[model samples]
Target chain A: EAGVTQSPTHLIKTRGQQATLRCSPISGHTSVYWYQQALGLGLQFLLWYDEGEERNRGNFPPRFSGRQFPNYSSELNVNALELEDSALYLCASSLLPGQKNTEAFFGQGTRLTVV
Target chain B: SQQGEEDPQALSIQEGENATMNCSYKTSINNLQWYRQNSGRGLVHLILIRSNEREKHSGRLRVTLDTSKKSSSLLITASRAADTASYFCATDAGLRGYSTLTFGKGTMLLVSP
Candidate 1:
């Protein structure tokens, strides 16, 4: 089975611009999650979508938003991006949300560089 | 404000040696997982230890969790140059569901051949 896949392996944007990243989860997975791994900063949860619904979010701002499609793929959008927004955006997929011990497979991630 | 905090921040060891990294969390968790990232690439799931389980092993990796201490440790035996990567510990907590993983800063491991 193919694993989670992400688009635009690397991206470069400027301040105040908008950036969009994409992720396709593994087959048979129902939960899609997004995380931001900034340089020197660890992986931080951004958003969680389950069955096409926004289930939970992290401590990020509203500018960081995303949605899960019917096929379980997800897109992360950042509006009015700041230089600090430059980071690696990762997407993961799980069999189900809230199921303890289920491993989440991650994509290669899209590295967004805000200039 | 990270949930799991790995100690030492960074480590450098020789091949055939052992590497041990520790993680501490503040809140209760249903399961704690470990992941390895090569360079800045995507993270790969390494192991997961449930709250009820104290110890688990996968090939060359050994993980131990102590709910009482609210901490966990990951040990890699006979480390190789391929094991040179960043290791992070994540927690699955809260009632909102287990999909969200709060990861730590991770420990950067460098293995010399």
Candidate 2:
């Protein structure tokens, strides 16, 4: 089975612009998570979506938002982007909680560069 | 905020040697997982140790969890150049239903051949 997949491996946007990143989870996975890895900042959780519902979120601002589709794929949209928003955005998927396999599988990530 | 913090931010070792990284978290966790990331690419799940478990081993990787100390350690034996990557420890803070993992800053391991 294919692991999680992300599109637009790299994206470039100017400050105040908007950026969108996409992710498709594994075939049988039902939970999708987004993380941001910035230089020197480490990996930070952004959002968690389960069964098409926004389950939890991180400390990020309201400008960072995303949604999970019916097919379990997810899209992350960053509006009014700032230079600090530039980072490697990763998406991961796993079996829903209470299932046997809850280990998350991650995508290659989309590197967003805000100029 | 990140719940876990990895020690020795980075490590450099020779192939065939052993590499050990430690992680410490603040809150109670249901399970702790280790992941490996090559360069800036995606992360690969390495191992998971539940709260009730103390030690677990997989292939050349051995993970030990100390719930009493709120810490965990990952050891890679006979390391290879291919094992050079950033290793992170994540904690599942949720106790009941779902779990959202909080990752640490990660330890960068460089194994020289």
Query: For each candidate, what's the DockQ?
Result: 0.71, 0.56
TM-score, chain A, per candidate? Answer: 0.98, 0.95
Residue-level lDDT of model 2, residues A6-114, one tens digit each, is 9899999999999999999999898888999999888998988889988888889999999999999999999999999999999998886445326888999999999
Give lDDT tens digits, candidate 1, residues A25-106. 9999999899999988899889999999999888999999988888888999999999999999999988857766788999
Q: What RMSD does each model have against the real structure?
A: 1.0, 1.5
Which lDDT value does model 1 have at A15?
99
**Which pairs of residues have clashing backbones in candidate 2?**
none
- Residue B59's lDDT within candidate 2 is 100
Please state the error at residue B18 of candidate 1 in Å. 0.5
Off by over 4 Å in 1: none
Q: Is the docking of candidate 1 incorrect, acceptable, medium or high quality?
A: medium
Considering only chain B, report the TM-score of each candidate against the true chain B: 0.96, 0.96
